[model samples]
Target: MRTEKEYVQWLMSVPRVGYLRCRKLLEQFGSAEAVWEAPAQELLQVPSVTRNVAEEILVSRQSYSFQEQADFLKRTGIRVLHKKDPEYPLFLLQIHDPPHILYVKGEFTLLDDKAIGVVGTRTPTNYGVLVTKNLCTELASAGVTIVSGLARGIDAIAHEAALQAGGTTIAVLAGGVENIYPPQNSSLARRICKQGLLISEFPPLASAHPGMFPVRNRIISGLSRAILVVEAARKSGSLITADQALEQCRDVFAVPGPITSPLSQGTNDLIREGAKIITGVADIWEEYPDWQANYSHKMKDEAFQLNPEERQLLETIGYGGVHLDHLIRVSQLSQGEVYRLLLEMELKGLVKQLPGQMYMRSSV
Candidate 1:
């Protein structure tokens, strides 16, 4: 017996039943099961369901295999999330055309609700690389989930930085999650599955093509509170993401780059056109006072049980890791005192010690 969800999955699998068409069918019939039971004439009554399309749906339904779909999803460790599913991102629903179905790998937590899309040219200048790393690392360390397409350059850098910061990230793929594009990022995609998430609107194992990139760009922006363009040419896909962000009523942020560089033109144009100019993570935070306040409150809550000295040390350690020598100098505490406090804090699980005697707040 086909479950209601399997019926919806079957409906999605029908030829020519794109996101909009699928949505229309659901709206008209109230459920995929109802759509399946409806006669060809009834299916045709739904907007955009032409005679051919209705007939195709009927033909496809007879051939579709729910068990095969279930086995594929299980084999790939992918979860099929419909728009009506509680796990579907609430922000994505606000977009003009949210994908009716998302194939997701890994987990989505409440932390993902605070996300920023980081996009840029696939071939970036040294300056672009630096800016992307700094901004993404800071944003991730601040508990903002970094969202980006799993392309080379800025997107890969963003995901790497977030993982390095011990923070969450999400990769929105142009292809299916299992069919990682560019091939070079296969290792990175695997890493993301362990620490973050990989999501796509396409069926699992579907290979990406040129046409799917622009369509994939919308979800990158849709899933984020804002979109940050690090570097882009006068004509680039990054601009498409920024445009989608604006259309979705999400904030668009751009890093100002040298006017002499072609890579900077798109971002400069965005800044000139009233997109927020992001000099640093603080600039991004300024637009979301509630996020800043909430982060501050979280820090305070975590420190509520700590003594003054411990709290001071934790504050000094900050979000990013700091060297023991730097902590001692900045805290103006004796080497022996700093060492003793760090050991105590580590034991308390409030701080984590990294390679090179670096310390960072553990909660982030």
Candidate 2:
């Protein structure tokens, strides 16, 4: 195999071959060495490749220069990861499309941590600020490394919360590892590199651009086990990450807010569509059960499990509440069977009987 540095340079040499296109190139070409030796006509024939790409390949092959870029990266302390590198993120590869290369500055192995993406509006409401901080802090304290865009507002809050909890935070940039957008967040960027990871698909000299953000959003969700939307507007880019997470089969959680707040629209819609309604870190508990051993809040409590009858009873209630008669109707069980299960659930502290005998989840 060509070393990762050679692979990275070979990819960067291809014109218009950003992370996605380069990923496709590797999938088809097998290795950077083989790709480098391929005919320019064959390079031009690559799906979605342009004629300029073929020309760039022909030229970079004749004049390959690696020392300057390496020295520049070395000066900045940014490490480049090629698609074949073991340090390349494993979860990202599970996505339908993933970056072929990444420029990471900081502890590279933070990518190995069990991670969750926390995203929301760059311009957030007060409620967004509150819950973003709360969820990130709680999740980080529970041992999850928080991941998010390093934009303003909610993203910044998520990273700050992770740091506050002494947990790792990964900032996925739309620009390069050396480029900090929003200009004002340079300090926040520094802190993230010091305590966690700052990653970008773009190379070191790449600059910030609005068009790059949607692609960045994909990487944010791609590297995560689940994505938590703390606050988002109807058209928030955070919603894009939520959609990508769903496509990747990662669980998505959204924090709700006041109906009047614009930031709540996207989250409320996610809830209506059956995304997990996360009120606290415990909502994510079942997904990370082993992590509970480290938290005092969790270690202090005993967990409840369901017996066959209880499972049947819970399913009878379905996604919403159900009356005793309806539970009997859906379960096709006799009134005696329904009553016995409901009473058992109440005794086990799993359900509560309403005024008219409807049953729903217990607040406990």
Predicted structure with the largest TM-score when compared to the true one: 2
Clashes (backbone N, CA, C under 3 Å), per candidate, total 0, 0
* lDDT (Cα, tens digit) per residue for candidate 1, span 167-196: 789999988888899799999999999999
TM-score of 1: 0.74
What is the C-alpha lDDT profile of model 2 across 221-308, one tens digit per residue? 8889899998888978889889989999999998777798887999999999989987666567656777656665242122224566
Best by lDDT: 1
The residue pairs that clash in candidate 2, if any, are none
lDDT of 1 at 82: 79
**Prediction 1 global C-alpha lDDT:** 0.83
